[model samples]
Target: MQNERATDTQAALGTDTAPAGIYIHVPFCRAKCPYCDFYSVTDSDRIPNFVDALLKELKRRRGRVPSADTVYFGGGTPSILTPGQIERILGAVHDAFNMMPDSEVTLEVNPGTVSLDSLHGFRNAGINRLNIGLQSTNDRTLGFLGRIHTAEQARNTYRWARQAGFDNVGLDLIYGIPGQSREAWRAELADVTRLKSEHLSCYTLTLEPGTPLADRVNQGRIPSPDEAVVGDLFVFTCKWLDDHGYRQYEISNFARQDPGKGIDLRSRHNRKYWNFVPYLGFGPAAHSFLDQCRWWNHRNLAAYLADVAAGRLPVAEKERLTRDQQLIEAIYLGLRQTDGIDTVDFRQRFAIDFFDYFRKAMVPLIDGGLIQLASRRVRLTAQGMRLLEHVADVFIQALE
Candidate 1:
């Protein structure tokens, strides 16, 4: 169901030439979460300075990018900024890039950082979509994740977002916490379905080596769930959300199933990356890609600000993708989506018959019921979805 619509959507994207997306990373948090690995600082004092730097950076890169149809304000907590600040940053973007009429302007808001009025102000500032991080519906689990707001606060925030006239909202949830019970995981899915948000991103909890969560597990202060149980949670969550009105688009993302309504549930900005459409990234530590050449800004706030103030791009590293590299990436990205790889489209783009190229290896996977090959499209089966990493590895080796 999602596959047909998504394929058509992807095709239609070329009609307008697909305006590129811009990712504005607001890298500040009230307090860092134990499991978060995103670059964020707690120095609220630097916000004023950082906001100015952001505008300068935006203006600096203005004419370099294509017209933008999506501007995503992802953050340490985008809601941490006042409406005036948000407006100023977006004002700079308007002065710089050509935003489409129906642009998907998304702001990632943490629970406690936004109030009713704050949400209203955000909407007025031209934010059409809200991606709220409602990590878990369980209070204890919320606290365990070092979240500032209780589950109730998250609920209220979602309510406020709706009341603020936001018809498009996305909720983010996580499963596979240290002691997360299967029943509790189901309950979280239940709560999310009840909200009936247009998009859902459910991720399994991972303990990065340097994160506090990983340290606790390594020190034996807390035990991470066994891998087998975590895998089960992943499969169950995917099936449960699909059973409800959410169909999996990406491995971790589901869009509300609405064929009649024709609702655009897929994240247009994120789709650009998966589809290899060009995008530009601003703010410290953010990355940008165009024509298969990718570069990222300095990760440190100080260096980023200094460079922008001095009228220079704070690019820390860059690389131009080889044809082989680009092909690998396209396959890697396509396999991560529920629609999987459209071999017909791949052949058109790369001028190679995808089926013949991978026939030897694909035969085994198909026999194992891990992948299904139609006339010109290949996708993972329900059981195959759980083992995507391994399946992708096989493709990567074949590409080599």
Candidate 2:
């Protein structure tokens, strides 16, 4: 049933036909999450300048990309930008790139930063998809996570999106927090699922180094999330979501299948990142990848602005992946999704037999029931999904 459901999801998404994607990183935020390490600033004063620089950067990269089928506005909080600003940026995107008529345009929004009117404005401004950052439905958990919005506020945000005429909406949730219980986490999922969101991104909270949460954990102010408990929660989440009519396409993402409604809620832009499809990113701290080369812009907003003003790309550094590096990435990224890697495609791309090349690594993993090799493809077993990092390490070591 698991494999069949996963296969059905891959067919519905048709990721193979998605040519490319464009990502616009909005670096402005009202406040930062204590557990987040993504580059973002609390200064709204710099937004106007940032918008101008972003446009310049977009213009400078015209004709350097393929016709894009998806555009994603990701951020510290893209909702902080007015609807007018979002529309202006999107207009530039349409003019500069060969945007598909049916391209999926998504905007990441946080509760408390937007209203029903704003959401309506966003819908009219070409944002066909909405991903709300509602990390928890529990008020106490919201406070512990340093979220600016309350539980009621998050509920209102979802309600407003629907009222604003957004048919495809996704919700983001975090689990495995310090001191959180299994029953509590289950209750959180039950609460959000009852809202009937078209998509869900349930991520296990990570205590990233240098973040406030990590500092507290290191100082013994709070205990780190129990690995065993976290693992159990991960397994439970997959099963719970599966039984709830949501398909797990990627490790952290699930989408509802509604053929009757013609809604495949999988995130097209994000699929590019997992499948190695080419993409171009604009704005401070954005990353781009194409034809085996990956590059990123300056993380410092000042440097990015200055570079764009001087008619130069704000690229900080870039590298072309070697064959070995590409192979490693292929294995690592492929295993993270349900579809896994196509052995035949891998062989054709690299001119090496997949089984012969990774015999040592494949044997033990298959023996241990961590992975399965069948139907000319490789994929993780349900048990293997929870230990994804460790499984990837086994493959990485074989390459070494």
Per-residue lDDT tens digits for candidate 1, residues 60-136, read: 88867668899999978989999889999989999999888889999999998999999999999989999999998
Question: Each candidate: what lDDT?
Answer: 0.86, 0.88
Residue 37 in candidate 2, Cα distance off native in Å: 0.4
How well is each residue in 180-205 modelled by candidate 2, as lDDT tens digits?
88899999999988999999999999
Predict model 2's lDDT versus the native. Answer: 0.88
Which pairs of residues clash in candidate 1, taking residues 3 or more apart in a chain or in different chains?
none
Best candidate, lDDT: 2
Residue 58, candidate 1: how far off, in angstroms? 0.9
